[model samples]
Target: MPDGCCSHCSDFGLVCTYVQPQRKRGPKNITIEELSKENASLKAENTSLKVKLLSLSLCSLCSRPLQSLSAQANSSSVFHRSTPESATTPPSPESPEEPPDEQDFTGDDLAERFGSFSIDSLKTKHFGSASTFALANNTLAMKENFLGRPLLIQSRRPLYWDVLPWEKEASNQGSDHVLKFPATDLIAALLDLYFTNVHPTIPILHRPSFERSVAEDLHWRDVEFGALVLSVLAIASRYSHDPRVFLDGEGSLSAGWKFAKQVLTIRQLSEPTIHKVQMYLLLTLYALGTSVPQLSWLFLGVGIRCLQQHGEFRRKPGAHKPAPEEEVWKRAFWSYVVLDRTNCVFLGRPMGLQVEDYDVDFPLEVDDEYWDWGFTQPLGKPSHMSYLVLHVRLCEILGGAMRRLYSSKKAKILMGWDGPEWEQHAVAELDSAMNDYVDSIPPHLRWDPQNLPQGTFFDQSAILHITYNHILIVIHRPYIQKNERPKGPVAFHLCTGGTRHHSHREYVVL
Candidate 1:
């Protein structure tokens, strides 16, 4: 502290009084009002002496000790010093050359600053939060600032383990790929690649809704929204041109593992919503890319159950038109079904969601922009979402084939059938259904490999052919091997056309 600066002033900036008051008792016969006037005059006279405190600014005192400030200003003009010499006395400690905001301070002035700005709030919890991840990292889950205010923590965002390019050089090696443990700013690159490459295939997230949430900056406070954002970034990283994506050991497959792991770290119990379902599906896609189909299956199963719990699966009878928010859920539910049947056929596992259990309608053919409550015949006019609506319808046929050809013991008992005869009968029925579906596909999106679509409809056309062929292979899969057959010749004729394509190689590898 300065030699005579007020020791009681706060540690930052505060004006300290150096004036010593000189007062004496009044004589008898002096009225009480006259004594008050003389005392007030003396107080103003003492304030006339000019004094300046070193490095003191007015801004810090603006809010605190407001009484001292107002008193000096109000009394200065009305009550003046009695002597003529006091007229030339410049100013007191309360006044400075510049206001607090206008004054500028340098490093030298900051070196000896002091004030008390303690915030021992009655509401805040003093104890630290329990966190296994933070404990492992040797850090507090709830950190405090220099002022002793605890940071607000809302979500369990996964620690980032990605290192920057320059950072890798300083470390001399990135052999372990754990040079850093926090996320960097790669959101723009990842989002661009994801929406272009990944979203067209999955089409689970509604673009308009996602964009609006991002614009409103809701992800920082909303747990489910933040989780979905992380999941998307992870999926998009697989297609990013940025070299950092390839730092993980698994090549392009594990490129987004850091973000995927972050999503995994988050744990909270809340009502099921469309955002949670979309996040799960995105995580499932990332897991599938990273050669962890078991993790993919886990995420996929949870997503389907969440969709069911959200009540989008059961259609309301004579229902009123849905709000835009509600329409997104309706669309997300169909997306879950498509993914559900896809995993069911590829993994050769029974379905987690059943067909007959729910009677939900397919999503509109209208794009997200035009999809609104009370909109007329949503599926009547075709738009950007036409591809997804068609994909959902195609997956329904695939789900039916799973139930019929690949029957369960309970199903077999209920619909009694023998070996070869049942196989032949099932193939004929499914073949007819598939043929009808194939004929129903829009002419522009028809699955003809030789006459491929060129521009906007190109991806849509390409995926339909791949899905159609894959489902055909699954329909005749059981009868392909003669060894598995009991006694008779199996159906080799049905497999002739579907397995001839080269595009479905990706699906088979997956």
Candidate 2:
């Protein structure tokens, strides 16, 4: 801008031909040189502002929505430091070097902070939450909302909360009285279908324990556990070729809606237990499998909320179990987490639950049958739960990929990542982590296109490989140009993985 090309363009190797026009061409005390110097100064200021705007638009893909309300609350200091004179200075890398902590939402009370906004506040924080219909209708609004992602449970309209179908079904005696476990003859077939086709992939429920409970007919005596059984029946019904699965007047893919609906009707979330969590999680799977995906979110949301209540917030895993059902809850909770995160990425929705909110460790890798007994990790055989453990760990990485590649720009900026190079580093770190995870998988559960594992291992292998490829596809999805075909094998592997999901001839490819 020194009476010629501007400095802003020089950094980008471009020459700006912008020149300040003479105002009125009137002679004054200010010399022509002074006027030229002032115009050049203004040009430099504009360029600095443009660079900052460009970074905000391109560098931060998901940065806007998840921005910290607390940061906006404190941005007055940032804005105040920028005097009109500083506009002529070049943009500094240090400005975003030390951003406020995102989790600092816990400390700010909107009511107390009213003083700041009314006094020295620059009005930056007035409307992040409010703009998105996230008004603080309750006393715990600060704790209730994080950045802009909210807890799904709080999103329900409070006025109609009590009238939700689940609420009314609480007193309904429909499924509680009518639906008994299928006559003794049908139970075997449904349970077989569930363990054979479904349980391998989920592996959240303890098959031996569940079978023992059924043998004793104990599930029928307890309403909550009975709901759990019904959920299992609903999920397994999808895999059943038996006519009994549809004796209730529903057809294929909907063979067990009654049982699913019954579980929803009877299992009030008022008392959160491991059985309740498992019930909701299975219901979520059932909803998806039955092609009623609209219901999956509700089921998943309830399941996660219930899992949070079991004190997972404060526990850690050791060599052994915590209490009677502690290990069960832990396994089921992770399954719920995987489901929640998978849904977020697959559907492009925000995460329902962040990993930071809980502290429970992954379930021990021992087979569920031996989980009760000590270190009896099946000798010379594949542990039934090992595949599931690997899958959960893989999803943890997927969650990280989402945060790293797809989370708000504000998050990356706060963390001091300022350019596309940060993304490359993140991708490399994630790719390395993925490689280690694949390597760490036990031999039986590893992906083998030639000799896919059999029986229990089959479904687990299919899901693990499918999810592995799915994560690869997700991580590199941005690099795929708009409306263009992928130029690599990620898509091919995903296609093959889909074919491997089921061992049926149709799902098998030669």
Candidate 3:
């Protein structure tokens, strides 16, 4: 046994074994050399591990405070992500000096830099120093004077259908003519899509009347109804996700041939009718769904004008009892009401048609087939009409919130000290109203995991729940922005529940 072998083995508690002796070297020397090599490798590994630990410990400023990061990102201002090309380059003289530590950059610094600029200017003017803080690499790069607000990268929209080469190419020799009108099969598919998917939720048109128009080929016979039919197809196109028919869901104006025709016709409509009103409503919904809220708001105004022209707001003078046509008009009027109030809440505008000015009761909860005649009784519990009634009730709640929280005058009033109290009370009332609305829903309409029904009927219940959650988020979002409503799960629940479970089902049947 070697003298130092025991020392090495005793320290590490590793047993030293016998080895073949070299010419002049014994087990002691061999063991010492082996121990030295093992110690060197271990030391290198420890040093490497320490380097890794240090690198892992370092986090970017933007990565830690996600709530604050999201708040800053969601602003309508522009933010710049540092490309790999930009990151490796030497700092330019134009770039502002970055703070040594994340702590050195205070919220006050953000305010001082941004406080003077108007939102319009902020949105329009390109800020030089809007370098994006990326969480992926935990990297920070300073830009010029302004700190960049985080923003989603927007995709380029397609060119308008008029500008596309479809017409020009068709005009050239040896090319097939671009479609001037929708094909029979395409129209059939679109109409089927609308009736099966879109109509169940909204149910604005009388199905019997619409089918009669379809049977007569009213789309070609009546220009106005033709325009309205095109709008219905446009809205239905959104649900199709069919590449040939709907080229882009985001830019509907530039996508489908039928949608473009609808827009052109609506723009040139010299005389407006109830059909025109219906067309505008469907167009507004398509616009809103396709990320063109301003256009939706504009269409809302046009639809309201047509409705008012037809005396949709007041009951007819000679009729003691409601006629079938009268009932359709009432349903149409309330559809406008639902849309206008919801749009106003989103756009921060005053309600165009106040509830106080109207006196029509909700349309009877019967299927559209019964609108003109036959079977006044509902067929099933979760029928289309039940969804309509629930939607109307939701609209009523939405209108109340709009009047209290989102009206331009109300918004102005909310900027004062009394705003907090008003906000709290209003939010509470809305929350209470939403709960009651959900409670008021028939047991069949309420969602149940154990008793999930098959088909689009499930969609009504899902829509109710999703819309309720969405409304809850909208109502409490201001409070959430103010750091109140910490317990509110509306946003998270919507992302998880609304999108994951129901959003696919909402349009799948259509």
Q: Indicate the worst ten consecutive residues by lDDT in candidate 3.
A: 120-129
Query: What tens-digit string does per-residue lDDT give for candidate 1 at 206-285?
Result: 67667666656556656667778878887787777676765555566557777677678666444355677889988877
Q: Estimate each model's TM-score.
A: 0.59, 0.60, 0.56
Query: How does residue 94 of candidate 1 score in lDDT?
Result: 28
User: Among these predicted structures, which one has the highest TM-score?
Assistant: 2
Show where candidate 1 strays beyond 4 Å.
1-185, 246-250, 372-381, 417-419, 449-451, 483-490, 502-510
Could you tell me the TM-score of candidate 3?
Answer: 0.56
Across residues 5-79, which tens digit of lDDT does each residue of candidate 2 receive?
678877787867667655685668889999999999999999888656534322111221222333331210101
In order, the Cα lDDT scores of the candidates are: 0.59, 0.62, 0.59
Off-target runs (Cα >4 Å) in candidate 2 are 1-178, 247-250, 267-269, 317-324, 415-418, 482-510
Q: Give the range where candidate 2 is weakest over 10 consecutive residues by summed lDDT.
A: 73-82
* Per-residue error (Å), model 2, residue 434: 1.8
* Better-scoring candidate (lDDT), 1 or 2: 2
lDDT of 2: 0.62
RMSD of each: 30.2, 17.6, 24.7
